[model samples]
Target: MADKKNRYNIRDHAATYWENSPKWRRVSMSIAFIAFFYALPFLNNPLVNTPGSDFQSVLFYPVGMYVLMAIGLNIVVGKSGLLDLGYVAFFAIGAYTMAILGTHTALNFWEILPIGIALSMVAGVLLGTPTLRLRGDYLAIVTLGFGEIVRIVAVNIEAIGGPRGIAGIPTPPDLFKAKFTILDPKPYYWVLLTFTLLVIWMVRRMAARRPGRAWDAIRQDDDVAQLMGVNTLKYKVWAFVLGAAVAGAGGVLYASQILSIVPDQFNLNVSILILACVVFGGIGNLWGVILGAALLAFTPERIRFLSQPRILVFGIALVVMMNLRPDGILPKKKREHFDPNWKSVEESGEGEIK
Candidate 1:
C-alpha cells in the first residue's frame, strides 16, 4: 500500500528520481536546458514569437529584464520576508548612473557597470539601515515613498535631463566583432542571458549557504530568529543590498541596450510588475519565479492583437490564477507535515493511540 501510494505521488516521485540520478546526468540535463534557452532566438518558432513585435527585442527588455529583477526581488519579498515597494529606486539609480557617466565621461560600459552596482548598494544600505526595523506594511510604505522620492528628484534635477531624460547612452564595446546596435538585438539578448545565468548561479550558491539559512530563519519568524541570535537586521540589510546590486546590474544592461532612459521608465508600475512576477511565479522557489517572470512578461506581447482590452484579459487571468492557486503557480515546497493529536483521535474514536 505504501509503495503504491509513493509510486502514484508524482511530485515525490519526480523529486526522488532527480535526487537519485547520477551527478553527471543531472549536470548534462541542466546544460541542455540552458542551451535550449540560449538557442531560443534562433528557433524562430511562430508559436513562441510575438505577432507584432521583434521577438528578440522583447526577450531582451521585458522578458530578460523582468526575470532578472524578479530574482532579485524574490530575495527580499520571498526569502527574507521583506516588503519592498521601492525596488524600482535601485533600478533607476543604476540606470541613471550608467546614463550620466556613459554620456559625460569617457568610462566604458564595463568600467561604469561596477560604479552603478556600488552606488545602488550604497543606496540600499542607506534605505535599509533605519527602515529594516519596520515590519510588514510599514516597511512597504517607506519603500514606496522612497521609490517616488527618487523619481521626483530625478524629474526636478535638470542637470540629469530631468523629465526629458538622458539620451545617446553609448552601447557596450563590440564583442567578438559583433556590434551592439539597435538593429540587431541578439547580441544584447545573449549578454543579458549570460548575466542572468551568472546571477542565478550566484543566488543559488548563496541560498544553499549560511546567508540562505539566515534568510529562511528570518522569513519563518523574525522575532524567533533574533531571539535565537540570528542577527535579523544584518541579514535583512544584506538581502536589501544584494537585491539592490542585482537591480543595478540590470539597469546598466537596460540603459546600454536602449541607449536612452527617462524618469518615467523607472516608475512605480515597474516595481509593482516585478513584484507581481515574483508573487505569480512561486515566491521563494527560484525556477518558479523565473518561469513566472518570463510568462507574465511575454504574455502581453503575445496577445497584442487583443489591443487595449489585452490588459483587462491579463488582469482577469491573474485573478483566475490567484483564485485557483493563492500560493502562486509554483509556490515554494514545504517539508513540514501536520501531526494530528493522538488524544483527540482517541476521544473522537477515529483511531487508537498505539
Candidate 2:
C-alpha cells in the first residue's frame, strides 16, 4: 500500500496561470463565464450570426447540458467509486417527465422542474436500492442495462410520443420583454449555464464535508469503509440520488431548450461520453472534470475540417492516454489525514513495515 500520508493528496497542482490566480481574478473569471453565452448572440461571429445558422448555439447548449451530466456522474463514478453506465436513464426520465407534463398541461418550465427532478430521484432509488450491493463490473453492466431499458420503454410509450417524441415544449416565461425563442438562444444558454454553476458549487461544497469523506472512503474500499462504521449502503444510495438529481436538472434544461426530445437522445453512448469526460478529466477532481468537459465537447467541432470520426478519435485518445497519463490531465488529490476518520498507521499503532 502507498504511504498513508501521501495516499490522497487534494493539493492544488494546476498550471501556473490557474494556480496563481488571485481571489479577485477568480471572481472576475466566474463573472465572465456567467455572461459568456448571453453576450455571444450580439457578437459578430459569422459562424453563429450568419442567417439560418443555429449551429453554434445548438452545439453549446448540449455541451452545457452534458457538462452538468458529467458533474453528476462524477459524484458516483469518481467520488463514490461506483461505475454507473446507466446514468442516462435519469436524464431520460427528467426530460420525458418535463416534456409530457409541460406539453400536455399548462405547466411552465419552472413548474415542471421539481416534478421532473423528483421523478428522476425516484428512479435513482428504484435502481440503487436493489443494486448498490453489486461491485465492480457487475454494477456497471447492470447500469448499462438499466439505461437501455429506459430508452426501450420510451420508444414504446405512445403517450410520450413513442418513437416520434414529444414536441412544442413551451418556452420558459419571459424576462421583462425578452423571451426564450428558438432563434434567440441567449436566454436558454444562460439558464443552462446558471444551472451548471449551481451544480458545480453544490458538488464542491459537499466534497468539503463528511458526505464527501464517506464517499471517498467507500470508493477506496467498501470493506474498510464499513469497518470504520460508515454506512456504505446509505452513502452509496445518496451518491446515486444526488447524481440523478443533477442529471434530471440537465434533462429539464435540454428539453426546454430543444423544445422536443426523442428516446434516441438519451442512450448508452451518451452515458459513455459523459463518463469519458469524468475519466479524461481525472476522476475525483472537480476542476479537472470541468476542463475535460469543455475540451472534449469543443475540440471535435474545432477539428471538423479534418472530417474525422469523433468517437473514433475519442477512443484513440483514450487508448493513448491509458498508456501514458492514466491519472488524467489533472488527477485527483487529497490532504494527508484530511478526514479525521482515516488515521495514519502510526496513529493506529501499526508502525511502518521494514
Candidate 3:
C-alpha cells in the first residue's frame, strides 16, 4: 500500500524529472531527442517503418495528432483563458482546404498546404473579432455554435465534398520526388512531427517575450490588463490565430495521411477531446500539454491487456487523478513574490507571505 501511494504522488514530483541532470547529460538528451523524432519515420529499426512494424504507427501517429491539437488548444484555453470549445472548426478548415484543392484543382500536396493554413488563420480572426467582448461562458457558447456551424456548412455544401466528403487525397510530395501513400504511416508521422516541432519552437519563443506576458496578463485579469494599457483584444485575437494555424497545419497532415475527409471528422467530439488533453495536462505549460495529449491518446492501446473493462478503468484512473491533482498532472511552476517587508515570512516559509 505504501509503495502504491508513493508511486501515485503528484506533489512530490512537481518539478521536472530531469531538473537535476548535469549539463552534459542534458545536451546529450537534446541530441538524442532530435534524432529520435527525425529518424523514427524512415529508420530501419524493428519498431519503425519495417514491413511488420505497425505497432509504432498505431501508437504514436494518433498521439502525434492529438499532441498538435492539444498544443494548439493550449494557446487559447491555457494562455488566454478563452474557454473555446469549437476549435476543431479550424481543423476542418485546414483539412477541407487541402481536400478541395487537391481533388478539384491540379495542385500538389505541398502547394495546397499553405492555402489550408492561411484559411484557418482567416477563420480564427473572423471568429475572434466578433467574440472579443464576450467572456467566460458566453465566449464558450459562441465558439461552440461556431464550430457546429462550420460542420453544418461542410455537410450541406457539395462543392467541398458535402455529406459524402472528399476522397483519394494525394500524399505529400517529398523533396526526393518519391511517390508516397497514406497506407505507409512513416512519412505522415515524420512530416507532422516536423511541423509540431516548429510550432513548439515558435510558441516557446513567443511565450518568453512581451506577447507571452500580455497573454498572461489578459488571462489573469482582462480589465486590469486593459487598464494597464495592454491591448487585450489584439492579444486574444493573436492567441486565436496562433492556435488555428497550429490546428490547420495538423489538419493538413492528417488529411494527407488519411487520404480522405468527411465533415463529421471535425465535430464537437474532437474539440472536447483536445480540450480534455489541455485540461488534463498542465494548462499554460507546453510540455504538460504534449505529455497529457500523448498519455490520453495512447492509454487505450497501452491498457488493452487489462481486458474488457479497459475504458472503464481508464475513466476511473482519470477521475481519481483529477480528484487528487485538479491543477493537472503537472501544473505550471508558480513562484510567489513577496513585498520587501515580508522577507522574513518568505524565508521562514511561514505566515501569509503572498
Q: For every model shown, what is its TM-score relative to the native structure?
A: 0.92, 0.84, 0.84
* Tens-digit per-residue lDDT, 1-354, candidate 3: 122233443433644556777889888987899788677545454423324235557544568899988999998989888888999999999998888888788998888888999999999999999896786678898999999999999999888779889998877887565456755676677677778888888999998899899988777667779999999999999999999999998888788878889999889978987888898887877878888998887676666566689778878878887887776786665432223433454356422101
Model 2 TM:
0.84
- Order of all candidates by TM-score, from best down to worst? 1, 2, 3
Best candidate, lDDT-wise?
Answer: 1
> Model 3 residue 336 lDDT?
20
lDDT of each: 0.87, 0.79, 0.79
lDDT winner, 1 or 2: 1
Query: Candidate 2: where are CA atoms >4 Å away?
Result: 1-11, 15-55, 334-354
* Superposed model 3: Cα runs more than 4 Å off: 1-25, 39-53, 177-179, 304-314, 336-354
- Pairs with backbone N, CA or C atoms under 3 Å apart (clashes), candidate 2: 8-334, 9-333, 9-334, 10-333, 10-334
**Residues 85-147, candidate 2, lDDT per residue (tens digit)?**
999999999889888988889989899999999999999999998898876577888999999
